[model samples]
Target: MSVGWIRPVSGLAASQIVMDDRIAQAEAPPGLYRLDRNWHCDRIWLQVRNVLGIPAPRVYGWSSSTDNPVRAEYILMERSGGVELGKIWHDMPWEERLEVIRTLVGYEKAFVSANLPMHGSLYYAKDLPSPSPSQFLDSVNSIDKGETFVVGPTTNRAFFDQGRGSVEVNRGPWPSLNEFVHSRAARELACIDKFSSYPGQQGLFSGPNQYHPTRALKVEVLGDYLKVATQILPTDANLSKPTLWHSDLHSDNIFVDPSQPTRILNIIDWQAVNVSPLFLQARHPSLIEFEGPIPEGFEPIILPDGFDDMSEETQHQAKNLRAAQSLYKLYEILILRRCPEIAHALHFRDTLPGQITGLASSIFSDGEPILKGMLIQLQDEWATCVRSSIPCPLSFTPEDRTQQKRLEASWSEGVELMHEILTEVGAYQGWDGWVNHNNYPVYKERLARCRENFLDRYAKTEEERSQWIQAWPFEDKTHSPTSL
Candidate 1:
């Protein structure tokens, strides 16, 4: 098992044993070439827990080698003491929920205020290939035992994906935020040169519309992103400061007391931490993310005019949504009061440079159509894209815009199909024509039926039906756009 229970040193908390068993994973790297730095990934993250007052499970003991009796690199932690936030959240009164939101935002304020010297993951000084104990001894606060944590090469998977894992790329404790972004862009550029031909990301969307996504299109869009990176990156010292952030802060990770509902005991799953500039790191936490109307700045949210006329169920859903939106606005308001730079960075997503940098970060996964659409929109709204005298660097012809429209439509269908796969087919972990032994026969039969039904209902002609069958996602010879 990748996870297990452990005995905590303290009687006040439970224990959680998380093990990064490389040998157990189906896709672990070859032992001969796997970097030693990677073995410390799960353990080194906790270095900040004590310094930042982040109430996560403490790492009692850990190892990066598999020579021990257990034959694995494992992390033992003091598990959180309280119940999951999901258990008591929806059932609580409005005041209790607000308190929870306030507590969560308070912790975030601490995170944003921490201005570190570089962008990278935390590692012990001695664990590095060439120990530099004297250099980064002050990166994070020292442990009580005199052990030091150092800022080292980032363990972010993006730098390693698509066969770039062991290759010499600038995965770094980047001295500047701009350098971090440049290195990421450069890595993606290198991948494009190696694997240029990728089909449009249109898998699993059971739809008839199809459009070709090209490497040329990706290059054109990424070039504009590069222009933003090099020339228009925010120069404000506050925005450029390398900060540590927890990327996945959801309700499930947060634990609260069942007796005193407002008390948050601890938060779990801090493994997806990242060290990037504040502009890229600021985002609404998953707990407070809402689909309802959100106002500009710290504006107050008002109930809709027809709330009294709506159905009971609709009104209930609307009230819940409004509460969630209030939580979102409250988070911004709290940041504005405590750390205004981070608050400003929160709204930076709407600006031209922000959009470019934001979209560029996920370009490899987001693919062609979305990037092309952003470029076209920016070009069309040139006057508003940039507030200054600098003209927009991108221009596309009408024909290019028209093709982008088709690609967008196809991409939307693919997205909807992916949702269906997640909720309906239970492909939540991502399916690549594979299923567990117990479900293998059942999935195979269901897939055959789905193929026939899709072809019969959606295919325009005999040739189209044949092509659709050949391109089906859950079968032999499945295609992956980002596969190395």
Candidate 2:
């Protein structure tokens, strides 16, 4: 396949090409693209753009005429010129930052208006055969049982004998919360754990088990939290209407062109795009805090007060951000309530403040104390749930026990080593001025070592281990000079 004179443009993982120097990209074959391994959602992006008539890079042009089969799989897209909104947010004037937020909201609204299929609906087909009708019944029989079906990676059909019978179908477009929870819980948990373990300091201490020092302690805490989560799972009334969403809208995925101000130049990596209710989209604090602290001597484009001053205009945007974050906790609870198997495997329990605080801390890294307090309150609430005789929604298995223990130990040792390295390298001189003045090379080297350790300890096989090592250098190599 020939890419028709397309040339390389800036990108981290996938091959980005500019078509004819004007159109900015040529088409490529499906499943060959590697920005993300999951190619299922990429087709969705092509479809969405086609339906909306948005001027996206061309796709599906692959043929023998293309010079490179690999290059032909992707469309050449014009590289938008701008700094990432994350980098400039803190330094930009407050109004400018608000403008960016407002722009993001508009983009999100546009996405929802497109009425694309929800992720679950796209992936899980009701007409598909299952191994057993009884198995499908099991999924619908109870919340906890349904969750077990949801969280595991295998499609529902894989779990039962399709030859035996057809599974019962729901009447509406949206799956029941029970069904969605069961269907998605496993993948979400796996993705969280896997990505959190990405070979870098940035990935560490960012998930549910960060609080405890030992595996037992972490599991004990998690076990209790699961019980509380189950109790707090939003009922049917809380379920919102389904909409198209960039389910994985985080800092790295969104590109900003400062010149465009109101328009985001590009939203990249649509691997996780899915049709789902707004409620299912998880929040990430890093995305919201794109404009972090500004460096000295650099002229700021967005002012610090913008977030505060533009609060009125951005209140809905802020609410969406908050909702995204809080939904994770809600998911944790719903999964536990729906799937006793997960609870048994992980010894999950419902703790009130502990889970909430832990989630908040993970989201807002800077607000540790407040998050910690919230976690404490969550723990107390779990105790109340226990006393009330609500069926405890947690269970654990030996594998879960072992993994939990290993992760806790890894975290404690990693944090200690990180502190030592930071202290020796002078990276922690107080949050306000420390990151700005720190030696970046030293930080990068230390981070690389941390990544190595994480891969060595947690990765499943040698090949899997090697992949992470290869992926690490790209992180350091791809950033622009102005990024720092």
Candidate 3:
């Protein structure tokens, strides 16, 4: 399994990094793989972190390993003293929030600037099982003269999750963006072939509206995606360039010294960091990401024309909403000023975001309609998007589009309802049915209420109520039946 390095780390083997959570009936979750991923998380990105010039934990002694008395791994480093920013984010005044924005812009700048060559996780040479060059010794850019580090297979959980951790598949430190993205279809195919049952389009709302996908349909979608993706992706060759991203950047992960609350002390939880193509990595930090509509361009923040005539509660809500919109716009402005390259990437994605999203489409995605829609979009746009002389590999009928649009609309409606419920319950980001221990009771009660409300409003008959109850995602799914 992958091991944590003093900084961040990643590896390329399913046995080395992938894990399964369905434990009651499935094999034990790969504890070693988690250790491996955590070990390398920050270490691999040390150079970029160095670029930001942020103070990081000083490693006195560290190793990429899973061998020890505890049968796990740990990094021995000098700790930075700071409280989690999440604890006081809301309490921070406007000026402090602005400072937070500026500081994070610098991070965003660094994330976009650093150029790595391969699409994989970084690992120490010694940590690999095989010392031979044929197995693990390949990196276009080594961190040191002696080449202590090497780019290995990705530790992205998509490769390892479910029961696929034990299966042999190409978990690569891919040499090219095409190879990296092309692996999506192969990966799904491998999972379908290896596992008896696979998780098909799972989500909180998707549960009550179960999509019983077929093996043949899954294969067909993957085939279409593989063909169309080959013709339409990388949108820009520059987007093909590998860039490292910390995917998760919530306030809790960014620590601040209590004495200087606005100053970032350290960013933690560096596990699962992946060096992906710019198209995949191009996104604002989660802390800066907004909900609902945000203003485009660097427009000034202002209240609605009749805001003063609103009720006190309405005014308060309006003020909060305006502030959120303003902050997100400000973040964009900061990007434009400090990191124009990043700004350009964001603009490119905004205009043709589907190309990037569609690049990730495959059999194992949420639903057939979404998958089919992406493939269809790619096929439709090939002439204008790719400008390829060759004919496109896929097409969809008007009937297919009409039917898929209805399904997509239903999916969106379900997502919106689930999102409202999530906000009400204070569910963890993208939470399906599971919650952390500290919030189990509150979440359980809230979820039960949500389920009841859903039944009252949508469950048309006793059979429907029974179906939804069985499909309610908030319940513990660890003990649920599994196919893959």
Candidate 4:
């Protein structure tokens, strides 16, 4: 029952960074052995591998507590020989980097071209019960209930279609695409109420924009706009099609032949792989992007002539920037030729300037200032686009422009309010601060200090905790942010 590793597989062994030293083999066999403490999720690796026929590590044998062991789960896979591409990426010549990009593009293009039953995560459907929306939700909630570190595995079809964002949007296995998108819009808007339940989050739930007076009328008005916008957009079939996306496609996840640096050996980490709308899955691969504004307006991404002459770090950044543009350009071409709706969704400079006006009020997102401006621009574009259509409901009047501005202000106000509350509660330092979970200890300490040093003379009962929380935010019931 025991397996031995002949030697350490340079890029294949479970590194200290990825897993513990305890999960090692004495020798590298024809197959790589992987022991995972929590491998409850069904191996979608096999499904994706078979369907896409992409060059990735092939799993030959696998077992988990449910089927074999009482403790760790194991996967024995054919070892693809290679050095870690990440270990030598920056040092590779420019030609080699371009070759890698060209090869990777081919791999990505092939994987994306494969068809699927629907938009969701891929799972092995054999021996599973037919999926339903309710079953999917129950499975998700059950997964959430389990130990955070140990994800439970299930063959439930419903388990695969979880959506992105702060909440689950596409809780599916839905019967139709229309239902999927409609449900998504409705649920996202509903999340506004959920965010407000937090004492610190009341500010966003209360207002339309940062500058506008709170009014119920404004909230109703925003909701109406969102419903209409979601209905009109996503008209193309590609926007509804299911496609695979590997979110963690960073350098560490890739292996390459050292002698022939451009040849990929294996791609690891498929656990978070999701099959969703092409728009959701079509982001530029991590290796090809640097953290910055997305290249938009169908602009060409160019690497400067002196890119290699620059410092090693600068050269890497330049390559990543160029790669980002190249990848996005490739996706743009694919979408334009095959799926214009998905293409339109991705081109923020063209469609986003209009589509966001409809999306802003319906969806709660971070980066309020940036989003508000984008929505304002989209509204103007939307108005212009609809102006020539006779009897168009989307036509913008001067009053409509004023309403749009009001909505932006109201949304910004709510964003600011939530930030302020979180700050007051010591969960965050400021509106623009990085959300650090590490601050939690400090937050608890501050809370203890506040209760010890700052209790009011009038508050002596258990009800006083609410009073204290309210007092910190100066919660004014008479003047809700959404008030007319």
Estimate TM-scores for all models. Answer: 0.80, 0.43, 0.78, 0.56
Candidate 1 collision pairs: 14-79
> Highest TM-score, which number?
1
- How well is each residue in 305-364 modelled by candidate 2, as lDDT tens digits? 456666665865654444433333333344345532332322222234223422421221
| Residue-wise C-alpha lDDT for candidate 3, range 312-369, written one tens digit per residue | 9999888888888888888888888887767766666654434445434435544655
Model 4 CA lDDT for position 286? 76
Off by over 4 Å in 4: 1-43, 60-81, 131-170, 189-191, 194-222, 291-345, 348-350, 353-379, 383-484
Q: By TM-score, rank the candidates, best first.
A: 1, 3, 4, 2
Best by lDDT: 1
> lDDT of each prediction vs. the true structure?
0.64, 0.39, 0.63, 0.50
Between candidates 1 and 3, name the one with more favorable lDDT: 1
Candidate 4 lDDT over residue span 1-484, tens digit each: 2354423333232332133233343233556655433242234555445445556677665554444432235555666678778899878887687677666656666556665555544433332345433223211123332211111122222222112233444455444555555555555444544444322233444321133222243244455455445444555566545666566677877899999988887787665565555554555567766566666667677788987689999998887777666664665565466545444545532356234543442343232333434444545565454443523333446775676566666656656655644555664442222233456467666655654444443346657645544434332132212311
**Which TM-score value belongs to model 2?**
0.43
Can you give the lDDT of residue 66 in candidate 3?
A: 51
List model 1 lDDT by residue over 1-484, tens digit each: 3222222211111111112233233232222111122445444445546666767665545557777545665555555687988887789998888788777777877786664658887776766777454336354665542356666788776666434453466988787776888888877666665664432243453334554445676676777677656555675778767777777677887888899988988777665465678888877788777676676656677777899999999898888877887877777777788778777787676686677777776555456677778767767776665545776767688898898888788877777765655454443242233455456577667766666766677678987887776556564443333444
Model 1, position 107: C-alpha lDDT score = 80
RMSD of each: 6.8, 14.9, 6.9, 11.1
Report the poorest 10 consecutive residues by lDDT, candidate 2.
157-166
